[model samples]
Target: MPIFTVAIPFYNDQNYLSKAITSCLHQEFQESFEILLINDGSSDASLKIAKNFRNCFPEKIRLINLKENKGVGFVRQRAVEAAKGDYIVWADADDVQCPQRLKTIRRFFKENPDVDICLHDCYFIDKEGRPIDKQLKWPKSFEENPLYFEIKRNYFFIGFSAQRAGLNIPFRSRCRDFPEDYDFILRALFKNKKLKLIPEKLSHYRIHGKNRSNRHSYTYRATKEILEGLNLSELSKMLQNSSCLKEKEISLAICELLMTKENFKEALEKLKNGNHNCFYSNFMQGVCYFFLGNNKDSALYFDRAYSLDSTEPSVQNNLGVLKYKMGEVESAVELLKNALQNKPDYLDAQRNLKVASNGRNSLSITKKPLRLSWVY
Candidate 1:
């Protein structure tokens, strides 16, 4: 068996398929590794490109052709099941891997037998394969607990792994629009799997028009579904006791997950049960109350939250909405302006400001129950 299986899954990526395959073929590693190319019923020329590569290097490459166009979740599950290597390394069909990627990952896994997952950073490249000015890097706090960082941003690439391919396939029928990689990583983390980062830009991630993660609404819904399936309360307790996260951070994380599912009362209960008296706790409580339609308590909590951190944009925006509801137009306008000044790109604040500035007292015109910064 090969030491690594470089799994590349594609649908209609004829343009970049050859480059992606070639990058893997050009790996500097001295050990044997197989490149498993999966064709998800593509109508494009992607299949021909994959076949030509396989014919040229039959010993190093293999191809799997599905009769129907299954989504990425299904494709990934199939890849894991078919992979013959001890370690499965994922390389997107449109992305390019550095020549040293496999060598570095192999060395790490051989030295650290206890680690289940290994991740490396990537450089962002435009569709033309030219390097963009920016590279993606995980924060240092990721070393504390990868789950917390994953919740904040799905920053890591689906690169090297020592995980059992059969585990956490994320092939749920309800999670049709979910991020399969995010789901897989979260599942592994929840199982107390050890994750280590290589801190190297070992891959080139292509930013193109066909990227699925650009659909914010669909991504949000899918992420919500994934989070809902997990035992969040239990996860929160685990993080609270062992991870580097603070009490208020854990409470806010749980509240964010609950609120996204529209469980306002449950979120409020979580906040109330926690020993947190910080700004995030008060802000989340206010958001829950607002969503629950208990405007009086909502305003009370928003006021307390504002007192703790007056410059916070979410607090300002939420308070401004409450002021408009209470017929305090002038105060509402001022708070909304403050929120805009602090965060110019805040869509909720901008919308609320527009409505308030127009002398619109209608609650339907305003957006309320804005999430605090810590939630993301």
Candidate 2:
């Protein structure tokens, strides 16, 4: 049997399937590895492309054909179930692996036999296979405290980890709404699995219009699912060893998610148990009050959030909108201008600035509350 199995789940990805497969074929590791391509009922010529490659290297490639279109999560779960190597690595059909990818992963597992997972950064590429001058590095704090960092944001690449065979926890379905890979990693974190980060870009992540990470609806849904599964008692126990995470932070995070779900009173109640002096807690409290139609209380919390973290564009813009509602037009305009200065691409601030400038209060400030990820 091969030392590693690179599983690529395909679905209407004909345009880039060849490049992804070719990258795997060109690996310099010279180790025994098999490429398992699962065609998840793609209507396009993706299966044709996979067949062509399989014909050229019958001994090294395997193909699984599914007649019905299963979502990415289902396809990935099936792929993991069918993987036939000591270790399995996920390879998205649209992404390319580095020539040394397999070699690197195999070497890591060999050197660190106890490590169940390994993560690495990726090179972001455009649709035409050109590098896009961006690096996807995990936060420095992630290695020391995976639970805390994973909750904050997902930075792991699909091919970043090669797990040990027979690790039966299939990728969770609720993750289909979020980036499935992130949720998969989170599940592993919840199990307290040993994770190691290899500080090298071993894969090329192609960014395009079809990328699931770009969909707001999926993000909302996935987050909703994650929040529903979160328990204060369980999380407190998990973070006992984390350097940065604490009970207060976790409570406020849940509070923010509750506010997003429009459970304002419940969110406020949760906030009461957290550190009100914290920037994020204050910001979320402001959001809850704003949605509850208490402009005075909203402004108070917004000001506190701003005082704690003056550089946050979301905080600046939100406070500016509240100031506008309170008839502080000049202050609102100034704050909105500062927000734009901080983040020119912030649509909420830009729209609010224009409305404030035109002396119109028609724009709904609570229309799309910014996610915690947007706070900076």
| lDDT per residue (tens digit) for residues 103-139 in model 2 | 8888888999988888777888889988787655456
Predicted candidate 1 versus true structure: per-residue lDDT over 1-376, tens digit per residue: 8888899989999999999999999999999889999998899999999999999999999999986888787887888888998888999999989999999888888888888788877778899998787745456688678887676556545643435344543433344445877787887788887888877778888989778877766876677777777787678767887557876677677777787678889889988988578887787788888878888899999899899989988888888899889988889889988988988977778888887778776543222334333212
lDDT of 2: 0.79
Candidate 1 lowest-lDDT run of ten: 366-375
TM-score for candidate 2, please give it: 0.87
- Residue 206, candidate 1: alpha-carbon lDDT: 91
Name the Cα RMSD for model 1: 3.5
Clash pairs (backbone) in predicted model 2:
none
The TM-scores, one per candidate, come to: 0.86, 0.87
How well does candidate 1 score on lDDT at residue 36?
96
> lDDT scores for all predictions?
0.79, 0.79
